[model samples]
Every structure is written in C-alpha cells, then in structure tokens.
Target chain A: MNLTQGTADPRPANPVRVVIVDDHAIFRSGLKADLGPSIHVVGEAATVEQAVAVIAEQRPDVVLLDVHLPGGLGGGGREVIAGSAALLGSTRFLALSVSDAAEDVVAVIRAGARGYVTKTISGAEITDAVFRVAGGDAVFSPRLAGFVLDAFGTAPADIADDELDKLSARELEVMRLIARGYSYKEVAKELFISIKTVETHVSAVLRKLQLSSRHELTKWAAERRLL
Target chain B: MATIPVRPPLARSSDRVIAGVCSGLAVHLGWPVKNVRVGMALATLAGGAGLVFYAWLWIMVPTADEAARRNARRPASPIAPAVSQPSGPGAFAPGIASPAVQAQGAAAADMTAAPLPGPPSAAGASPLRGASGSSTADAGQPEATPWFRFRSMKYGKEILLGCGLLLVAGIMIAQMLGVDVPLGTLIPAAAVLGGASIAWMQLDETRRAGLVDKTKADQAGGWARLAAGLALVVAGVLVMVSGSGSWEQTWLALLSSVAVLGGVVLVLLPWALKFWRDLESERAGRIREMERAEIAAHLHDSVLQTLALIQRRAGNEHDVVRLARAQERELRGWLFQDPGREAGQLSDRIKAAAAEVEDLLGNAVEVVSVGDAAMTEAHEAMVQASREAMFNASRHGGGTVSVYLEASEAQAEIFIKDRGPGFELSDVPEDRLGVRESIIGRMKRHGGTAAILNTGTGTEVRLRLQSAGTDAAEGKP
Candidate 1:
C-alpha cells in the first residue's frame, strides 16, 4: 500500500488511485512501476479473494484487473467484481490480460469492467486507459472495441425480437462498432463523426436497449449471437 | 507209405472254390474233403453265420502256392541262426533245411515268442496290410480306373465315338431284324452317356481343387458346372419316369433318382460355397489394403513431415519447444476432433493461428484482416502457409509483426510485415529448409505464390492464393 508519489499529474486535486489485481507478482509489480506517480498504486492482490478484500477496503478510483486469477469461487476477475458489488459505484474496473480472445473480452466487459486491453500494449496506453475509466469513460483497444461492438451489435431480426427498434440506425451503427471491440475514437473515425457524437449514440443505444453500460449491451448482443 | 509230413495248414489250390477253406481244413485235420464240404453247406443253409466263418478262414489259410510265395518272400528271421545251430532234436529232424519246413517252424516260433519283433501273424497282419494296400491302391486307382484311363488315353475320344457308332449300328441291325427299339430306353441311355461325358470333360477333382486356389475369376465356370450337373440329373430322372410302364413304377424311379442326386448335391454344395466365400474375402482384403496404403501416405505427407522438421531443429531448444507445442495442438485437433470443416471465416483462422504462435513464442502479432472470406478449399492451405510465414517473421523480425490479410472474391492475399533488419535470401544456408519447404513449397503445391522481399525498412512475406474462377498468378514485386 504505497501512495506517496502523485506529482506528475497536477490537473486533478487527487490522483487516480488504482488497485492492481493480477495473479503474477512480477506483472503486478511491473505494471505498478510503469504506471508512475500520476496513477497511485494503493494496493495489490494476486487472487480474486484478495482482490475483493483489498478493493473493498481501499475503495480505489479504478481497479486494474486481470481476467484470469486463482481462488474466490473460481470466478477470477469477475468474482472480485461480483463480490465487491457494493463498491462498484465508486470504484471502476479496467481489465488487463494477455488474451485477445473475443470471449475473454466480452466476459470481463459483461462483468462490468470499464475497458479491456491486451498486455502487449505500451505501459503509457494502459495508464491512459486507467485515467479514462476513472473519469467514467469506456476505454478499449481498437480491435478489442471491435469485439465489443460485434458482441453487442444487434442483428436485423434481433432488433424486433429484443424490442431494440427504438434505437436509430446511426446509434445502432455506433453501438455495433463500439461493442465489436473498437475504441470511441475509432468508432467516431469509422462513422465520420466526432467523439462526442459517438458518445451520444452509445448512450442512446444503451438507453434504448434499457442497459446501464456498454458491457451489458455487449453481453446482450453476445447472447443473441450477433457477434 | 510215404509218410505225409506234418506242416502248418495250407489250402489245396487244385480243389479250391472260393479260396478252398473247407479243403484246407479237411487236409489239416485229416477229415474227408466231401464230409467237410457237406457239413459247410448244411451250416451255411442253417444261417448266414457259416458263410462269414468260411470267409474268415479263407483269409487265414494260405494256399500251397501262397505258402511257397511267403517262404520266398520272408526276410530270413534272426531265429534262423538258432534253428541252424540245431540245439534240439526237433531242430535236427529230417527235411528241416527245406524252406517250407523252416517257414512253418518260424511261424510257430513267432507265435510263441510274443516279445519278438518279427512280422505279425497272418490274422493280425490283415489290417496293417489293408491300410498300406488301400493307400497305394487309392494313389494308383485314379490312373488305373476305366474312366480316368479312358479319358487320358491318346485315342480315348475316338474309342468313345466308336462305341457310340457301335451302339447306333446295333440299333440299325435291330431295326433291320424288325425288332423295335423303345424310345424310353434310348433316351435314358443317351442321358447316362451324356452325363458320363460331361463328368469326364469338366468334373475333374484335380481341376476343381485347383479352382479353389484360384481367385473369383472361376466363379462363372463353377456355376456352369453346377447347372450342367443338375440338368443332366433332371433329364435322367425325367427319361426314367416317362419310360416306366406304370405310374407307381415311374414315381419309384423318380424318387430314387432324386435321392441319388440330392446326396451328390449335399456332398458338393459346401465346397462350392466355401470357394465363393474365399474369393469374396480376397477381394475385400485387397480393397482394405489399398485404403491402408492411402492412409499411410497421408500420414507420411503431413504428420511425419512435421515430426521430421521438429527433429531437424532439435539444437534450438526454444524453436523445438515452440514447434512441439504448435504441433501438439495441431495433431491433437487432427486426431481427436473433426477438421473444422464448418469453422469460421479465413480471417478468424489466420488470427487464431497468429495468436497461437504468439502464445508459444511470447511475441506480439497484430492481425488486421480487411475482408471476410469464407473458407474454401484453397483457404486452408493459404492459412497454413501464411501461419508458417508469420511464425518465420515473428521469430526473425524486430518489433511487433503486422499481418495484413486482403481477401477478395478473386483471390486472398496475406502480407506479413516486420521491422527487423532483413537478410538477403542468398544468406540463408542450404540447411534452413523451414522457409523453402514449409512456406514456399507448401504454397507452390497448393497452386499459390509466396514472395519474400527485403525492403528498405524490414522484411515482408507475401502469400496469395486464388479462389474459384481465378487463374493463379506467380509472385509479383
């Protein structure tokens, strides 16, 4: 629990606090070292049980989560989030894994993780993702965002079946790109719209589907085999 | 009176009828021959027991000529030396040197000396002699039998034709004498002659046994023989039935003919069926052998080649481990699972392969596929070759290797770009077969093209495979 250094980012009065949950000690320490002082590492846990306990006690602004872990009813990162359901309002979850499998991405996202990025990405990209998730924005790698968009995008028949006809075609398009594992910037670029407009369509799509988050939308689309 | 010398029993050859057992006994026991004959005839008239008894004694007693023949044929017994020594008065009796006397004494001595390994007594000797004699007779009988001899004779066919002519001549002579020949007799005689001819021409036991050794090529011939035999037997029965004077007699003739034919068929059917079954099994065995050869060739082409490649790179521990892991995944999938014929698109497979390679080598591979190409026949080969090229790039290149897949209806092309300091193609040693064989050769065999280029920035391997309706083009810069 080291949180002394926070000098690099002076924009926020309090720096984004992150609890690193990973099964590997070297990876946790490496990620912590790479995050620098701008993102304070308040606590670290190597398993789901420890992750839940630490996240509950620390109530960090964002939890940098690994999708697979040992212990805590075998749910891995999902178990930690489910176990700490109460603190989810205050604390966000950002998934970091070496797997780029679409199933892994959709599974963690469905469990209420704000973003999913592979371990191959640079440390700076991960730091940016954590801050963005801390600020209440969904972050995803370009390909991972495609996975989310594909998983959540409604098929033509499903729109009528799930009563998703309330969403406009533009909003559905935005949702498709976003839920298929594309980042907001990529979705905006793909649709030839601004990032703000992409955000507006995502919120509308979520609202029309009566979903609270993009993660749930992705789970809904995946259940319908849209991806 | 010249004293009749006492000797072993002998049948008198001159007074013999049916081997002269009564005369032999009469001589041996000092009875009158007429009394012996009258007594035998009375006993035979009483029951059949006397006839059997006569037959037994006939076989037991040797004739005077046969006794002389036995004396001539006898191997000089070891006991001859003892008799020659004349240790007893009996041995020194007069005429003892004569062969008949010596043979009689030896036979008596052999009967007494049970431990001696001399020839068995005449009564015991019959069965052993019968067994050996029958075996030789069986071996020689085929050659000596009239049918076989007739068939084998140089002029046998002409002699048979002459016999037919003689029969016809006899019928004509009967006609000239105003003696009517019945059609029924003539038809039956023709049937019997025809059956005999067919059996002689076709039903050779040696040839049939040879057919059993041959393949199914002789199946038609076997059926023809069966049909011919059945027809002949039926014709004979029909002719016999029609020729009979009364309905009861015709039925009796028909029943007897059917019973005889049925017995013949019952004996031969099993052999015919077994021969047919053997031929069928031989054909099935040949087909199975061909299938096995095909499977063996497929294993040699794929799995064995991978195993050989794994062995060749044994010195590179990392490469070996990585290749082993990849091969294990592939082989397990091949052996345990269906070959994913209904799998996802080509892009998905390419991504999956890249991910697998990345996992094995701890490297980063960024797969960016632009189009969705449903997997076709050539897609599998293209994916495999592209995976190999990607693996090569990842192993030798610097920075994250980027795979760009452009799949169109006409063709699908994949380019693997890496930022490493690329070496000239000539710099690769002859022993480095991974690129030449697994990548280039694999693509070539699939009617695809693979090009390795050293650009200013890094190395790029391009693979292109044509789909349906497109002519396969060679590598282009």
Candidate 2:
C-alpha cells in the first residue's frame, strides 16, 4: 500500500485488489468498512471451498482467510483441502485462526498461507498483514515467527551438481525411474523404449558411477542430494 | 604427505549392461550422477560400456551391513566370555563361533572387562536380519524380472503424468506432420492417463508382495505434481526456443525457472526423505535385536542361578517340585514374552513394582503385560495405576488384585478390585496411602474419577476415564 501511495510507483492507475475470505459475514462487512475507499474489495468467500472458488473466479490479489469453521476444512464440500497444494495459485492465503495449538497452527501455515494471525488480533494488524501479503511478504506473529524459522531452519543441502550432471537426460530419466524402484522392463515400457535400452542404461549408470549396485546409487544420490 | 587424494576418474555404475557401473565410477572420481546416467544412455545407445567395475564393487564392498552391525546392536551372550564356565556344554566356547566376527572377540572383551554404559543390550542394527529385501509375493518359481517398481500410492498419478507427456508429444508430432489434433482432447486424455498411472503404481508387483520391506517405500506422491512440473519446464523451453518477439520474453525465462525448480523438487525431494528414513530404520532395528539378545542372555543366567539355589534349599522332593514350579514360571516369563508381548515392552516402573511385590512374598513371581494396541500417555498412567493397586492389594488388602479394563470410543474404564475382606466404604480414610494416592492420583490427571464403589462385596474400585485412550493409540501416525 505504501508502495502504491508513493507517487513514483510504476503500476497503472489500478487499486490494490482485495478479496475477503472469512466465514463470518459480519467480519467481512466490518473489514470492508474499515479499509475505507482506497483498497478495492473484489470478492467474498465464506469457507475454504468458497475461498478457492472466488480465487479462481476473481484472481484476487489478496485474501483474508479464516482457519476453521463448522467442518474445519470448509463446508462438507467435496473440493477439499489436499496434499498437493497445486490449486492455490497466485492468491495468497492469510489465516485467521482461534487456535494456539502448535500442531493446528503449524499445519495451516505450512499449507501455503502467506500470513497467519490468531483470531485475537486487532483489525489494524490484520490490515497490515493484508498489505504485506499483497506485496509478496510473509507475515506471522512473533511466536509464530519462531515456529516458521524453526520449520525452515534446515541447512541447505549442498547437492553435487557434478553427480547430477553424470546422468544423460534419458539416463537420468531412467535412473529416476530406477531409483523409484522401477524394474528394467517396466521402465522400458514406460519410456516407450526397449527393455534392452533400460538394461543398458542401468548397467552403464552402475559402471560409470562406481555405485557397486542399485542401492548405492540410491545412497549416493541422497548424500550428494541427487535422489 | 604432500600428495593429492586421487579419486577414481570414472564412476563404476555407468558402464554395466545391468547396472551403470561406469557413471558410478565417474561420479566417485568427482564426476556427475547425470554424466554417468547420460554416458550409460549413450553406451546403451551403442553397446554396453565395458562393465569392469560391476564384478569389482560386488566382490569388494561388504554385501550387507547386516552382519557388520549385528554384534554391535545385539545383547552380549549370557555366558560371560571372560569367565568361560560352560554349563556342561562341549562346543559352547567362551565365545560364539562366527566366521565374519573377529570383532565379536573385541566386543565380548569390552563387555566383560569394561563397566556397561547402561544395560547388557547391544546398541544398533538389531532388526537388519528381519528387514529382508526380497518380497514374499515373488516366492516359488518366480520369473526373475529385472524390473522393480518403487512402491508408491501415487503411481497412478505418475502414469497419468507419463500419459500426459506422451499425449503432448503425440500432439506435437502430429502438428509437425501437418495433421491437426485438438489440444482440448489431448489435455483431458493426458489427465486420465496420469490418474491411471498412479493407480497402476498402487497395485504394482513390489507393493503387493510381502517380500519387499513395507516399512520404507517411494516418497513421491500426490496428483499432477510431475505433470505440472514437466508442463512448466516444457512451456519455458518453448518460449526460449522461439526468438524474443518482445522484451517481455523474459516471462518465458521466469516460467522456465519455476517449472524446472518445481519438477526437480517434486521428483527428487521424496527420494531424499526415503533414503534418510531407510538408514534410520535400519540402525534402529539393529540396535533393537542386540537389546533383545542381551536380555535373553541375562534371563538365562538369572534363571540358572535361581534354580540351583532352589534345589539346594528345598527340604523334600515335594517342596523341591513346588519351588521348581514357581521358578519355572518366573524364568519362562523372563525368557519368552507372554502371548501379548507386553511383559517384554513394559516400562521399568511396572517391572520394578512387580518384582518388589513378588519379593515381599515367600515365592518370587513376575507379572508381565503386553499391549495389543498403541501405547499412549493415558495407557501408561493406567498401567502405573494397576501396579499401585496390585502392590496395595497384596501388601495391605491381603488378597490377589484382579484388574480388568474396557476401552471403546476413546473412553476407558478400569476396574481394580481386591478379594480381601472388603473395607467399609465410609471408613476409607482420605489420608490412607493406597486409596488416596495411587487410586485418585492417576485418575485425576486424565480428567476422570476414582471411587470406592460397592464396598464389602470386595473393595470394588472403579476408575472412569474419558481420555485415557491416548496411550492405547500411541505409536500410530
């Protein structure tokens, strides 16, 4: 929002488009009233299901998401929360949860929410989160900040690009198939290549890498971060 | 001292017809898994790369770490190697006979000579012998196929992705041949193919067979992940291949980056997790077996000592028979677990209390309990409560304590009652240690109640817990 307010901003004369995704109608109305005239409220969704629908429909820049309701995940709707997280596109999810349980709190955060705030948060803080989320910044409360940091604190594994480079595109594909434990014939069938082709690839990979066997390929792949 | 550490120039895995020995050599010698894979691809494209290292690594590196870590993980032998006093045996040397185990001599020496860090239990790799690699489904006159599909719930998705890729390839080929095919038809076909592929993975041979270790399987899963990634990469490459019509062609580069990164993440991340998990589980199992072995040895020695003492003390043959009977019961429980395997996995407190009570009596006895269900916090509390009740009943209540618990729908009700002269319900003193501390203490923690209900009909103590089923469902994901 501050970026937009600075007259030197390069964006065309468009408002910061927003979508309200709270289960509570009253709060949505209150949020709209609170933001006043500058921010444009493009859509409203009452549950996670509806939120998804509105997101796909409006392509909203930002969404104020409620963490739980009657069924928790959404309505008893079929388009439910899933493991892939593919369906959640450009629209960022900013959670409003009443729970402080670390597991519940952490789960939603991990599920691609750009911001997570307890229901106890004031409207002012929520507005701040909305602005930050719209600008592509991650937002969380102080306690939650620690949780996020801990969750992502893993040291970046130094993958041996060299080990990865050893595989030809086709051989890499076959190796990946093999590492997935694909049998020679199955891999041959899958690649639309011959069973002999699969065998040849496997043998070559084994000899070239000095892996000893298929299992070492697996171990080496993991250690050098290739698997 | 001034020499460089020379790595092998080529990977052993890249060359072999069955395995990529050459690429493996290349990688070991500071090369790439890709280079090995590609080299193998070309070698397969030609003939096989000379598989010089295939026979070498197979012969050279240890076959399975299974044997290497077995002694380290298992409990030491019962008969102390240092004190070679055999229990009238011929081949029962001071040490066990294992050709692979010169290290056993050192381990045995360390065990007898050094103070044990904790228990007689061995440390790691106890369960390696158990996680045999072959699947049971491949038993009998199995057609030794060279292919083994990684066990995955989302194989259908992978297949679908493959189909999608093929469909796209087909469409592109058709377009090149100047034959028109609608993308609308192709896209849906791809989607269907992806789903079918994932389902195929689920029913694949490796998953259905018992021979494959089910504890670990392929980590990659979920819908359209590979498809999405491949699509992105393809789109990016296409954009770059087409010359920049506009400076906005940078969008193609951005899209390419996302696609490549996403595909790599989806494809590779799961493999990494599975590898780590396999290593962890292997180490854990080896340690567990060693522990069990040590326990078995300890129990054997303890039983022998007790039986000898009982034989010496018994006044008559009849007395000897009775003492022998009791000793037999105790020894059996120690060596082999009861039906449920509970007595074996019991916590120390329960074991200690059982021993203490049996010690108090003229006859030494051990009560063993095993769990058929997951052990949770509430279950542990209940187990502790049972120990307390058993102790109180034998010592003060003057009767055998009978315990029965029924659990359903997350609620557990435990009945701990003794058959002694039932104390008056009202006279149950608030400060009386057993009734006050043991009975009420555990119940209150689990948001439940303990009461001395229906007294004189044997002091019937009923504990009603609403959430004690937590411990019963422990160890489940």
Candidate 3:
C-alpha cells in the first residue's frame, strides 16, 4: 500500500537521495533495481572505507547500510557510522542486515543509525523505511522490536522522574504489538488509535534505544573501541 | 640367535648426555638409554672392559647428521630416508604420492621397524621409525613425538651433573690443602653420589613420560636405572665397611646387586606395559578431536557459504529455496550443535512444527524467535496453539506465513500472520471448533490468552502466556 505517500518530501521534485553500502555487488544491483523510481540511488560502496568516502562525497539524504562490511579495522557498519559522525544530523542511516545477531543491531542503533530492517523485507517496505528515516522517523523490524522490548523491561504506570530510560505505558503497548509482527496501520487499528499516534510512540522508544542512559553510552563507547 | 642384524642403522644420537655411546646403543637395540647406561657402568666396574667398549662405540658409530647425509645419497632402502631425517619436510606430507608408492615405502620401512619398539597399535607401522614410538606406530599423526625432550632432559640433568662435578672438585681441593680424608673413601663415595644422581634423573624422566605415550622400553629403562643406582650405593657401603677390601670382594658385591635388581624389573614389566597402552589410546582420541575441528572449519568456509549464496541467488524459485534452506539448517545444526539448547525448547519446537507444515504443504513459513524462556506447562500450551495457527495459515492462506516469538522473564508471546483471504471471527459457526477448541481453548486452559483478528489486509493469530509464578505473585490468572 501507499503507506508513506502522504509523508513524502515537501519538495516533490527532490526525491530521497540514498547511498547503498553492502559487500555483495549482485545484492546491491538487485536492491538498486528494487528501490523503484521514487528514491534516487546516488552512490554505492562495498566496504567500510569505501562506504565512508562515498557517503561523504555523495552527501545523500539516507544511507542504506549493511550491518557487516569487510574493511576499516573490522568494525563493519559501526565503523562507517563512527567515521561519518559529523554528518549524522543532516544524513540519516538505515541499517539493513540478514544477520541473526541482536548485538549487531543494538550496536549500530547506539552508533546513531536511525533504524534497522532485515534484508528479507519486501522492496516496498525498504523503500518506505528509507523515506521515513529521511523524514526523521525511526523504523524497526519485528526482530528489532523484540530486542527493544527485551532491552527496556515492561513499563509501569506513572513513570518516576529518574526513570527516564524506561519506556512509557503507551510506548510499551506499541512496541509489543510491533514485536508481535504488526504493521503500523495494523497496530493503530488494534489499539483503536491513529497511525501517527503509533509512529510517535515508536519514535520515542527509538530515541530511548539510541540514548538509553549514561551507563549504556559508556558501555557502547568501550565496546566500539574494542571493535 | 645370531640372526641377521637387521637393525635401524647404528647412529649416535645428537640428543645425548655423556659421549652418545649408551644412547646410540639404546636406539639401535630399541632399549631405553637408562638400561644401557646401567649395564655399561656395571660391566666397567666388574672388569674395566665396559669402559673400553664404550670408548670403541663412541669412535665407531656415526652421528645422526652424518647418517642422514649418507642415507640421502643411497638409492635403495627407503626406511633410512624416513627415520634418519625425522623432522625433514617429507616426513608428514600425506597424500603427496600415489597409494601404491606410499604402501611400498611404508612396507619397506615396517620390515626394518619390525623390532623397533612399541606394540603396533594401528596397521603395520608405516615409515618413520625411531626413539619416539609415537611416530613409528602411527603415520596419520601430524606432530613428531619429541625424542629430545626425554633424551636431553632440557637442563635438569645437566644442572644435576654440574653440581655433582662441583662437589667432587671441592673435595679434591680440600685434600690438596692437606685435609685428613682418605683417597679410598673419597672414590667409593663419589661412585655412590654419581649413581644416586643418575637414578634421580631417570625418576624425573618417568614422571614427565607419563603424560606422553610411554612404551615397554621406557618403563624397563626406568626400572633398570633404579636397580643400578641402589646396587651401586650398596656396593659403596660394603666397601666402606670392609676398609681396604680386595678387588675380588668388590666385584662380587656389584654382581649380586645387579642380579637382585633385574628380578624386580621382571615382576613389574607386564603391568607397566598395560598402563602405557591406555595412555597411547587416549592420545589417539585427542588427535581425532583436532581433526574434526579442522574439518568443521573447512566446511564452514566453503560449503556453508556456497549454500547461503545459492539461497540468495534463487530467491524466486520456491523449491530451490526450500531445498537450500533445509540443507543449510541441517549443516548448521551439525556444525554448531549446542548440547544445552536443543529441540525441546519452546522456540525450537514451534520452528520444527512450522517446518513440518512447510514440507507437507509446500508453503513457505518464516519463524523468528528472540529471548528464550524456561520450558513450562504454560509455554507448552503457547507452542501448541502457535503450531495450530501456522498449520491453519499454511493450508488456507496458500501463501507465505510469518511467525514471531518473543519471551521475557515473566511472559512469552507468539504472533502468526499470513497473506491470506481475511476471515471474520463472527462468520464461523459454533460447530466449527478448529479455532476455538485447538487455538483459543488450549491457551485458556493453561492460563494464557489467544486471539484471532482480521487485519484489514489479512489474518493475525496472537498467543501470550504469563508465567504461572508471576500470575500467582500478582494475584491474577
């Protein structure tokens, strides 16, 4: 369906510019073909070093990043994000992976990736994710949703002032539904709420996932150095 | 018997302690060096003939390096080429030559190696025979059993010998300063100390040899050293007691000691051989484990990656995709089997059910799980309900079905969605209990909940079960 039709860029003339970063050339070409005409493919890279340079030179609005790449001190996608830290504000990153590792998704998210989706997702779903990320919204697959739910335990009513890292009651409900494989529209209908309300709850949870607490930020920083 | 002396060439070992004579004779006869040393010492003290024999052996036998060079130049006798240069590049290169050639080389080596030592544990001992029975007995072993470790004793024996020499030097220096020690007592005392040190060195060798594959020769060698050592000490004490004893009386004492010690070794030989055989088998098992690990690494690098590439490239062909996925699953299970987490877990059971439905109906079912929980009655109920949902989606939907499972410390949840024609809960009659009895009723009976909803596009089955312990603590069912 046309899930992101209404949320298109304000200037219709300017499509969401994206750079594809994956190790497989065949997969990259296939994704370029599948991304359709709405999103423009500006540059492509096969390794971490090449990805960083291409991302900087293209200055694309969104970067479709693979969670595992070959180069740059073996840090993979996280290294690419760390290398282009200055461009995180104007350029959003959306990680796509076929890896069954939860730590990889969490590490990339903590490294300032806007969202994560599996490579198995439909072309339409990936296309919609790119636009949503470009518009400053967070996208999470069912697997990532489950990870977030597990990361932040079930929320209690009336959150205390010091529990800033905990998810809210409404956000918990939305995340649980997503973890149970619900689409945004399906979750909205299931909860008798608007799709925009569901998006707001999810984005809030995404923000918490990225900057959970000072302790978590410190842990991520240490882990990055080890990588 | 005075038969042909078809022995491994008489080459003096570079791994030697004194003049390389005893160790060289030991290797040639496939006897432990300690036994050879003790025999030579006894014979020397008896008539002074052993010292002359040792001196002749040292001059006659060539060093291992010279033997290896001579063997390299020879055209016949492939056995020497294998044993003469044990650490050479050609030693362990398997599959390099034709099978016929290898068998011929091995047979030639085995004929000369027939009486080498160590029971033939595997097939007839294949080339590479020498002091380390490990190499002689098994050809498949990639590592050469280190002979120098036993022969040289690293620096332990050297240090012991050094200390003994220093003590002798100090005694001599004191005598030169006009101390009242008699020369007769000093000479006997030196013999006692020297024999004791040699015995001590062999004891150390026995302890270290226990970890490796110790053979009959090694055990006999140790026993020989201990017997020789005690005999020497006894002879020294007898001479000290009979001050200014005649040479004939000293000879009788040494001969009796050797005879008595030989009996003790004869009694212990059988038991020591059996124990060392057990150790040999244990080492063989460890080598097998290492080979398995190597095979796993090779398969993971080549076969597993190729299967993954096949699945990715043939994504549209359902049959090809299914076959590749099944192969990948089987391979991964074999390569990364974790004994602690098996098919009995809730997630594994559900995935197995999905795979059954897929294989039976030819419909694709994707299962994803996160955060496993302890298996309980409530968890079983949820898995049963999820299995029913997957089968329903596969049979009726005629398209791909997706199953998602997430579990926390206190609760577990499953969601099954399909791209099927939507069905209304109100549309079914009371008599139709497929959804009610199997899916919804099964969950309620176990203190869980199951729901069937019609998303505007398709159908979604959601099942959730809170742990019974959590339910009681919260006072909710």
**Among all candidates shown, the one with the greatest lDDT:** 3
Pull out the clashing pairs in model 3: none
Candidate 1 docking quality: incorrect, acceptable, medium or high: incorrect
TM-score of each candidate? 0.37, 0.26, 0.55
Tens-place lDDT digits, model 2, residues B1-477: 113332322323424454445445555667665675575567655534323234444433322333334433433333221121111100111112221232323333333333433222211111110111111121100111111121132244446556766766787779779896664455445445544554555445334332333332332222234544555555445445444554335545656777998789657866865786697777667765776687677766776777787778766754564456456545533432211111222233344555555455423222211111223566577666766666665565564444433332245444455546666546877667776777677867756666664334345556655553354232100
* lDDT for residue B358 in candidate 3, whole number 0-100: 81
Q: Write the per-residue lDDT of candidate 2 for residues A84-170, one digit (tens) a residue.
A: 145455566666664332334344543456656655455655666566556554544533432221221112214532342144456
Candidate-wise lDDT, in order: 0.59, 0.45, 0.66
Model 2, which residues run further than 4 Å from truth?
A: A1-227, B1-42, B45-47, B50-301, B315-348, B362-385, B395-424, B427-433, B451-477
lDDT of residue A178 for candidate 2: 35
lDDT of 1 by residue, B349-380 (tens): 88788877676565667664433455666788
lDDT of 1 by residue, A1-227 (tens): 11222312212456889899998899988888888578899999998888888998999999999887888765677777788889877788988875434445455666677767777567876877777667665665545533423323323333442344334556646644443334566556667787766655554443333343433344333432334
Q: C-alpha displacement of B432 in model 2, angstroms?
A: 4.4
Alpha carbon deviation, residue B128, candidate 2 (Å): 18
Candidate 1's displacement at residue A96, Å, is 2.7
Clash count for candidate 2 is 123
What are the per-residue Cα lDDT tens digits for candidate 3 across B213-297? 3443486466648666675866657667567677457647656866786667556655765676587566556665665676678
Root-mean-square deviation of Cα positions for candidate 1 versus the true structure, in angstroms: 37.1
DockQ of 3: 0.07
lDDT tens digits by residue: candidate 3, A70-169:
8888778888999999899788899997654445667788888988998877787888788788877788887777666544544433655235567777
